[model samples]
Target: MKKLVYSILPVDGYYTFSQRFLELLKSAVSETFDLSAVIAPLESVFLRFETAYKRERKSEYTAKLAAADEARDRAYLALRHYLVACSYASVEGYKAAADTLLSILKRLGWSMQLASYQTESSRLGNLIAELGQEENAALLTTVQGTAWLERLMTAADAFEAIFQQKLTAEAADTNTSAYRLRKVLQEQIEMSLSWLEVQQKFNPSDKLTTLIGQVDELIAHTMTTARANATRKSAEEEALEEE
Candidate 1:
């Protein structure tokens, strides 16, 4: 299997779903991107441990730290990868490498989805305003009710998954899409808050909560749909193998 190994910088709560999805992604990529894991930083606490240990008598912990650094270095060099640094400590000369790694993530379909939501919505709203005055806005709003809405929603789902992990670097979303979309929606919600209040549609808190709820529902539905699709694909592949 072609492997795409991740030596994620450890942050509290980040590894859980990423580790799992790495496996699933590998399966999907088949000969393209095999997934593997090494010790990622458990948290920013790693820096403290490294500093303290370096100050004290060198011990196994120090060795482990060194190995982690080395393994982290080797892992990045080994394949297409993404590194999320939780600490501000520079990797010295590796800044270029880090940027390159991030670019690889972009190529691998890991991008912040928040930009699209704003750009698309604004363009859509403008288009509606141009088409007519009264009914055009309503029609544009109703476009969300159509069949292809699900596909865009699925893309949003993918955004959330990437954003969750990529956003905070710790205790974050395992699904990258979930992370990305939540970030985008949060931005949108913030932008719309004053308008919502002015229009008396909802209080700021209520609007915030509503947007959060929508994101949550989108994530849930996306996960269910992705799982069903995976199951169906596996079944079909197995049948083909048997034939």
Candidate 2:
């Protein structure tokens, strides 16, 4: 158990550390029924921690937003590429419709490809509006581009919805705050560990001892990395000050 020293564990590393510890506990469930009982409450706490992490971590939030943006971007690109391909079709009416749409696209005076995230949705909205006009709509119907345009509009709206729902910085002040959840997780882990330690002292199982050792190693490695990072950051700050 080695006191499960976690004070030195960095904030960012907390999720991985607790997750490793939880997995270690789960692995030992077949070894002892008592450990499983202790893990039940602890697992609930960790689930909350994970949910909080999605809200708290900027990287996680950005990854979701980026995914939405990418889908919309792909839809836009597919629409353009489809129109370009249609321009060379053998069907005379389809070729004319495609050429007219492509010409309008060029006359619009921009590539409209890989736009900045900030302006992309509105640009997509403008393109959608232009093509959705009565005249362009008729052209799109001939080439069956109406469906692709709808997909682009759907993707654009999806991205805008996600972008507009940006997370506020006050997450830490909320009930679902990762910081608060982490504190609860820490307490739950310590309590669970203490219960297990008492069990081992009374019953003395070899399986429990091995699991404890593995948990100790995981914690020790995490603490070591945290300390090294702290030292490196301090050194960098000192160098900047000297400069």
Candidate 3:
């Protein structure tokens, strides 16, 4: 598959946040992986897996560690993309994306914990529980400002579809589209979530139910786009290597 690259510009006041996030990702990666030796492998994986990525028959932690690195890279790339899209996002959409992204960072294991909130938007906790997700997995509260965030969360579900499945180093296969679309969703969700966070800080009046509805729409759009662009590029390359 083609490598995933997100461009988020035109978003005022978000550059610093995006840059800091990238720096944090870099630091976290450096602390975890041997860059010199692993950078190429990591890059290769990124180029191949962009979105339709899957874990090997490896241990969970090993898979999670590698996935974490890729997830971080994907998130960084997405922030840049959101900055660009920020200029056009509707008031509600912008807020939704911002909240979703912030919560996503925490959900992806990037942040250790969610801080308590004290504001009109603080009712977020209630909305999140409405989804009936797993414990501690509720990355953000379910408040009014979470509409964008909810949509972004749906995008994350698409991403998980890709990361958990495996691809072959062989000719095109039936699962290729499924894998790639998942990756695309992964990238899109990460960026959208961050955007939502920024939006919430500025406009806490957005409703949680509204954001959840928006998220469903966004997820559907993302899935369609990713599937249309499916090329089975990675599978072909893997097939060549096996020869």
Tell me, by lDDT, which candidate is best: 2
**Which candidate, 1 or 2, would have the higher TM-score against the true structure?**
2
Per-residue lDDT tens digits for candidate 1, residues 91-208, read 5534443444335335433322111333433433333233234442233233322223233344434434443433354234333333233333333323333332343344334443
Off by over 4 Å in 3: 1-170, 173-175, 208-243
Candidate 3: tens digits of C-alpha lDDT, residues 1-243? 112223211111122223333333344343433223323333333444433333322324335534543343343334323423443456545545445544544454331111111110122333334333543233223223334444534434433444444232322354343233434434543654554455456754335224434544544544444434322422443344345
Q: What ranges in model 1 sit over 4 Å off?
A: 1-204
lDDT of 3: 0.36
> Candidates 2 and 3: which is better by lDDT?
2
How many angstroms is residue 29 displaced in model 2 relative to the true structure, after the best TM-score fit?
A: 2.0
Q: Clash pairs of candidate 2? A: none
CA lDDT for candidate 1: 0.33
Worst 10 residues of 3 by lDDT: 112-121
Which candidate number has the best TM-score?
2
User: Candidate 2 local accuracy as lDDT?
Assistant: 0.73
Candidate 2's residue-wise lDDT over 67-186, tens digit each? 897677667667777898788888768898998888776765344533346555556777788999999999999998899999988998888777656535434345476655777888
TM-score of each: 0.19, 0.51, 0.19
lDDT of each: 0.33, 0.73, 0.36
